[model samples]
Target: MTNRRSFLKGLGALPASTMLASETGFAQGIERDHFSDIGVKPFINAAAAYSALGGRNMWPKVVEAMEYARERNVIMEELQDAVGKRLASLIGCEAAMVTGGATSSMTLGTAACITGTNEELIRQVPDLRGMKNEVIIQKSHRYSYDHGVRSAGVQLIEVETAEELERAIGDKTAMLFFFFLNDAKGQIKLREFAALGKKHGIPTLIDGSNSVPPLSRLSEYLDAGFDLAAFSGGKGLRGPYSSGMLLGRKDLIEAARLNNSPHADTVGRAMKVSKEELLGMLAAVEFSLSFDYSVENVRETRIVHLIADKLSVYKNITTKVSYPRTESGRPHLQIFWDKSLTPLTVEQAQKELEDGEPSIRTCYLALSDGELEVGAAMLKDDEVDMLVQRLGQVLAPRAG
Candidate 1:
C-alpha cells in the first residue's frame, strides 16, 4: 500500500543534503528526523520502481506542483475534469484521468466496461445481474494485478489462442485485457489481440505501468487500437507514487470518473487521488514529455560501466552490462561470481549493501545463476560514487 503516509515516511528518511539539493520547495531550515524518530530505515534504490520499496522519488517540479496544490480549494469534480482534459491532450489520447495507481485504473476501467454511465448499474456494481460480466485475458497475461479486474466482480475468461479467445467472447464478454510486458510469452501479440477486440466490438485495455523512458509508449497502445491503457504515475514518470493515469475512449473515461471518488457508494470511492496528487501527476507528465531522455540514458550507461569496471578486478568475478528490451529501457549491470572462490553469497552481498551505512538495495537474482542486478535509474548522481565504493568493499577478499 503505497499511500501518502508511506510516501511521507520515505521523504522524511531522505538525508538533509539530498533534500536541500533536490529543491523541493519545502520550508528552509525545518528538518525533522521523521524516519529515525520512528525507527524506519531508508536505503538507496538501485532497484526498479517497485511498490514495496515505496516507488521512486518525485521530480523537483512535481514536488513543487504538489506543494502548490496543497494551498488550493476548488470543486473536486471540476479539478478532475480539467486535469483529465489536459492529460488526454498531452498524451494524445481521447480522454484520461488520474487514479490511485495503475491498479485503481484497472478496477475503474473494468467497472466502466461492466456498467457504463447508467446510474442504476453504476450503484449496483460487483452485483452484475444482467450486465457484461466477463473479461477475456490470455492465460499468460494472468497476473497478481488482475485482482483489480476481478475486484469488479467479473469472471476472467482465460484463453491461449486467438480462436479460443473468439470462442470465449459472447454477450457476457465486457473487455479484452492485455499485459504489455507479456507480449512475447502470449500466443497472440499486441496488435493481433487488440484487433480481435475490434473485430468483436469489445473494448481493449492494456496495462503498461512502468513502461516509460521511451516516453512514446504513453500513446503507443492507444495508437495500436486498444480502447484504454493504464500507466503508473510513480514509475518512470517520477510523480506521486499513489497516483496513476487511465487514458482512452471518452465515454469509458466518463463512466470511470462517475464510478470514482466524490461520488458516493461507487466501487472507486475508496481509491482516492488528492488534489496534490492530481497536480503532481500532471506536472510529471509535462516534465517527462519535455525531458531529454538521451542525456539520462547516456548517464545511466556510464554509471553501469563504472560499477562493472570497479567490480571486475576480482579474478572470479564476471560483469556484463545488459540493456533490457523490456519496459525498463535502461542499462543494468549483472555481476556474476563463483561462490566457491568467495566467502560471500549473492544474498549475503545484497544484505550487506542493505545493512551498510548509506544503505543500498539491489536486485538479487537467484534464478540468473546467482547474479546481482544493479540498476542506475533510481540512483542519485552523488550516490553513484558511494555505490561503487560500497561494491568494492563488499566484493573485496576477506581475511582468513
Candidate 2:
C-alpha cells in the first residue's frame, strides 16, 4: 500500500512559499528588472483589469503555475483535456474549455453551436450560406460585444419580448445569445429566455464575462437550463489576461475544442490559448472558488476609509466611500468638489493624476461637477498614501 505522503509526493505538488511584505507596495523584483530596456514603464493599476491596463495583477499561485507550464512542453490537447475536466468540476458544469479570452470563447462557442462536430460544417462556417445562420438576441442586449457571435457569419435577430423572441426563432435560427450581466436591460430574463430556446430547439449561450467574484454564476447558469456559457478568467479570477473559459454540455464543449486552436482550418485556430495560459486559468479558477470574499471586502473597505479620511480635510470638498456588492463587489472612494471653488476641472484633476510622477490612472466620475472615483481593489497599501497626497495637492487651498 502507498503511504499518504508518498502518494502526495507522486502527485507532484510544489512546496509553498511564505507571504511577502505588502504595505511597501509593488514587489521589488518587478522594479529590479523594470522595463527600461524596452522604453516601457509600469504604473499603479487603480482601474481593476480594464483590459487596457495589462488585465490586472494575477495571484502568486497563478503566476507560479504559468511559469511552471512555460518551463515544460507537453501535448496541448492532453493539457487542455485534463485542465478542462478539473475546471468543470470546480464550476459544477458538464464540461469546460480554456480559450484565448472571453471573446475568443464566444466566437468558438458560437462556431460550436453552428457546426456541432460536423467537420464539413466547421470548415464551411462564417460562410453560413445554406445553414441556420441566425442568432437571436434582445435588442437591449446588443452591446458592442455582439461582434463576437457575428464574426462567425451569423446574423443577429433582435427582439423585444418573449413574443418577439418566439417570432424571431424559426428554421434558420441557430442559437439564443444572452448577456447575463445585462439581464435587467433585457425584457426576457435568463430563465424565460432559456425556456424559449429549449422550446424552439435552439442552443442557448450566455456571455458571463464579468459575472465572477461570486464565481457561482458558472454553476448557476448551467443549472438554470442554459445549454452553454462562457466567462472571463482574467477579470475577477486574476488569471492570465489572455485566458477565458467556455462551459456547457459535453458534446458542445467537445465541438468547441474541435474548432479551437491546434486544429488547423477552423475559425478558432487563430484564437490560440497557450499551454501556460490554460494552466494559469485553471489555477486561478481553483483559487477564486475558495477566495475569501468577506475578508477581501473588509480589507477593501478599510482602504476606502483610509483614502476618504486623508482627503476629507480639504475645504469645500466632499468624500464618500460607497460600494454595492451587487455592482463590482469592491469599495470605491468618490471625491466631489465645487468646480467654482477649485482651480481645476475634474478632467484637469484626472489629467494631473494621470501625468503624475508615477502616472496614476483613476476612474473618472462626472467631469462637469468635479467628481472622481478610486477603486480599492487595485490600490496597493503604500500607493494609497500617494493617491491621498496627490488629490489633496491638486484640490486643496495651497499656502505659499
Candidate 3:
C-alpha cells in the first residue's frame, strides 16, 4: 500500500513553480495553510464529490494551467471561443463552452433556447414577454437544480409519459430537459426524449453532471440527439469546483456565450467563470481523456478489498464490494454489521468517524439493512490506511 508520505512526495516532485507558494514573494518560499488559519478543518474525503465536501481535488496539471492563466490577460470572448473550439473538437461535439458550474450551464443553455441570439430577448430574461416561456420535463426528472433552468423565466411543464410530453409541446415550449441520473425512473428514456424534442422542433438539454469515467458519455449524449448537455468540471473531471462545460448545437452555444459573462444585462452575467477556471477545466478535460481508467479501476478495487479485509476480522462484521447503480462508475465498499454484536448503530458509527481526529466522511443509511458505503475514488493511499484503522477501531467490540 502506498503511504501518504510517498504520495505527497510524488506531488512535491511536480514543478516547484506550480506548488502553492506565497504569491507576493516567490523567492521567500512562504507557505500558508489558509484552511488552518481560518479555523475550518479539512477532512479526508472517503465519499464521492459531494459539493459540501469541497467537491474533488484538482489535478496538478490543472493547477498549473490555472496558475499559468492567472499571469496572462486576453479578450474574454476570444478565449472562450478558442477554448470552446478546442473542447468541442476533443469531445466530438458541435460546440462547447465553460460555465460557472453544471447549474450555470443549465441556466445559460435554457437562455439560449429561449433567446437564440436575439439581443432584444437576451436583455429581457426572466421576463419572457416575447420568448418561449416553457420547458418540458418528466415529473420524475425534476430536481432542485432545475431551479437554474427556471431562472431563465421558463416554467417547467412536467409529464410522465411520451404521449403527455408530445401533447405538452407547443409554441411556448422552449426546450425539453432530462436529468440523466433519473433516466431509469422516468417513463421516457434519453433517446426517446431527444426524439420527442426533435419531432417537435424544440431543443433538448440533459443535465449529466457527475456522469463521467466512461467519459464517452460526454459525446454519447450529443450523438444520441440531445441538442445540449451539461457536465460538471469539479466532479469526475477534478477541475475547479466552480467550473463546468456546456456542449451541443453551435448556434445555441453561440447564443449561450452571448448570454454569459463579458456581456451586461444577462442572467448568466452574474454566473461568471474566471479565465483561470476556464483553462483549468480545459486541462482537466485533456487529463481525463488521457487518463487510464482500467488502472484506476484496479486501484480502487484494491482499496475497497483492503478496507473490507481489515474490518472483516471483527465478529459479525461483513463487507461487500458493489458498484453503484449511479453514473459514479466506480466500485464502493459497503460495511455491514449485526447490531446485536456491537452497541454501535450505523448512524452512531458514522458520527463517531466524523467527529474523530482526522475526520472521515462516508455515506450511511438508517434502514434495516443499511450499510456504511465507502467510496475509494476520492481517497489517497495513506488515507485509505487511516480509514481502515479508524473503521476497525470504531467497529471493534467493547470489552464487557
**Regarding TM-score, does 1 or 2 come out ahead?**
1
lDDT of each: 0.84, 0.79, 0.84
Residue-level lDDT tens digits of model 3 in 1-400: 1122321222212232333332224435547988899999888888778777788777777878999999999888888989998888777778999999899999999999999999989999989976789999999998888998999989999999999999998889999999998899998999999988888899999999888866777887887889999999998888999999999999999999999998989989899988899999999988776665666677788998988887777777898887875636588888877766668877899999999988999853521136788888778777977898888888877765
What are the per-model numbers of colliding residue pairs?
0, 0, 0
Evaluation by lDDT, superior candidate among 1 and 2: 1
**Candidate 3: where is the Cα deviation over 4 Å?**
1-30, 364-370, 398-400
What does the lDDT read for residue 177 in candidate 1?
98
User: How high is the lDDT of residue 393 in model 3?
Assistant: 80
RMSD list, candidates in order: 6.8, 5.6, 7.1
Question: Worst lDDT window (10 residues) for model 2?
Answer: 1-10
Candidate 2 accuracy as lDDT? 0.79
Model 1 regions lying over 4 Å from their true place: 1-30, 343-345, 364-370, 396-400
Clashing pairs in 1: none
Give the total clashing residue pairs for model 1.
0
Show where candidate 2 strays beyond 4 Å: 1-31, 324-327, 343-345, 364-371, 397-400
